[model samples]
Target: MTTILVTGGTGTLGRHVVERLRQDGGNEVRVLSRSSRPYAVDLRKGGAELDAAVAGVDTIVHCASSPGGGDEQAARNLVAAARRAGVRHLVYISIVGVDRVPLGYYQAKLAVERQIEESGLGWTVLRATQFHDLLVRLFQAMAKLPVMLVPAGVSDQPVDASEVAARLAELALAAPAGRVEDLGGPEVRPLDDLARSYLRATARRRPLIRVPLAGKAYRGFRSGGHLAPEHRVGKGTFDDDLAARFS
Candidate 1:
């Protein structure tokens, strides 16, 4: 039986991956998280805890990330520890536009992707679009205001995190394919439209006002840098995600 270690196993995407892995009932799956839970080893210290978490693991599905900052250091520490532990495969989850988008969080993700590539270990990087739940949360936060301000000309193809998790599980079970095809949602919609949909679903009436953003990040998004139209492999749509959550 293959042994798999999933970092950030308690997180949104990582939990789904962990669930799918456990469904097989043939592999030994462990979670490396900051919190102490069942089958979990803490990696916050990043020394012996990290080393012990990776030791004897055949594959490491790296889903742990800090979007605000410090993700690069986390990735470096994990890669170093995995190397020392002789990990056979490493699968990383990244955003779709990390390479093209100029956002700080995207830059951090891209940096980690580069580190994984140069780590000299067998690896696969899956770049996925923004998650539907994130968009929903964003709209929820914006609904508090009189006018929901959205970035003008920005579009999004929000994929379901569960779909991404399933793909990650499959990749973890297979041989490493470096930088596989991007994964996007079923359809691309304007960010304003998405906000409107969210408001409608929740029965919250809010006027969505488009505001032009003058930054490299907004330009990238407006130019569809975060979209993978050709790689619309995900089946779930934003509406479907909303229904599942609310219904």
Candidate 2:
């Protein structure tokens, strides 16, 4: 049996990946956690434990990232560990508009992408749209404001995290096929509309005001840089998800 290893196995999406492999897939699974008892070994620090943990792994579902955490060291560590372990297939989850946007997170993701590309390992990179929960998290911190500030004329097509998780699992099971098509939600909506929906769900009444933001990230979004117009995943609508969240 091919033992699939999932990095950031305790994260929102990584948790789903591990569950699907163990519960739905019935595959031999190994999860890379910062602190898995019995101490699975620190891949970041690089040692005998890291080598031992990944020794027999056949595939890697790399849902790992350093967003708000690591700059690029996390990915480099994972790649080095995977190479030393001799993994066969490596599936990476990335953002849909990362190539077009100029955010620090995107740059970090790009660094990881390049590392995987040159590694000569059987690798697949799947780019997905922004997750609903990501939006919720962003709004949860700012929804309390009397007025929600958004980038004027920018748009988004937020997809469900669960759906993205499912797709990543699918990729983990399949052969590594270069860069897959972009995956997104059913409908595209303005940032203002998304903020409004978020406020409504949280029982807050706030006005959404759009203002011009200065940055390549803002410009990229304003120029349809975020929406994958051709790659609609159609798994969940934001409105439906809102209801489910409140229900």
Candidate 3:
């Protein structure tokens, strides 16, 4: 059986990946988190504990990420520790348009991708569109205000986290393939419309205003750089996610 370690296995996407892997049965799965026992190791810190967490692990699915920053440093630490442990494969989940989008988080993800590719280890990187949970969180924060202000001309293809998790599990079980095809949601829709839909679903009425922001990152989003129309492999829709969440 392949011994696999999953970083941030308690997180939104990581938990799904762990569940699918466990449900498949046969592999020895381990989760590395600050709160997990024995294997608990913070990816952002390179130390003996992190090294121990990677020992004897054949593959690692790196799902731990921080939008507040420090992801690049975390990747560096993980790569070094994995190398020391003689890990055979490293699987990573990244966001689509990480290279195209100028956001700091995207840039950090892209940097991590580069580190993985050049680490001399067999690696598989899967870049997917934004997840439905992310969108929901965004809308939830926006709804807190009396008036919802959204970015103008911005569209998103929000994929299901479960589907993405299944894909990641499959990849972890297969031979390493460097940089597979991008995965996207079933459809792309404007952010404003989605916000309105969120309001309707939550039974909250709020005035929506679209404000155009001037910036490279905003422009990247407005131009749909994050979209993968050709690889709309995800079958779940935003409405479906809303129904499951709000209902």
TM-score of each: 0.96, 0.93, 0.98
TM-score, prediction 3: 0.98
Task: Report the lDDT tens digits of candidate 2 across residue range 58-123.
Answer: 898887666775736766776778898888988999887778888888877877888889888999
Q: Write the per-residue lDDT of candidate 3 for residues 146-247, one digit (tens) a residue.
A: 999999999999999999999999999999999999999999989999888889889999999999899899999988999998899999899998999889
Clashes per candidate (backbone, < 3 Å): 0, 0, 0
Worst 10 residues of 2 by lDDT: 37-46
- After best superposition, candidate 1 residue 111: deviation in angstroms? 0.8
- Report every candidate's CA lDDT: 0.89, 0.80, 0.93
Q: Candidates 1 and 2: which is better by lDDT?
A: 1
Model 1 C-alpha lDDT per residue in residues 1-247, reported as the tens digit of each score: 9999999998989999999999978899999788846445534347877888788999999998876677888888888899999999999999998989899999999999999999999999999999987898888888889889998999999999999999999999999999999999999999999988888788888777999989899899999999999989999899998888876
Report per-prediction Cα RMSD to one decimal.
Answer: 1.3, 1.8, 0.8
Q: Report the CA-based lDDT of candidate 1 relative to the real structure.
A: 0.89
In candidate 3, list every pair of residues with a backbone clash. Answer: none
The TM-score measured for candidate 1 stands at 0.96
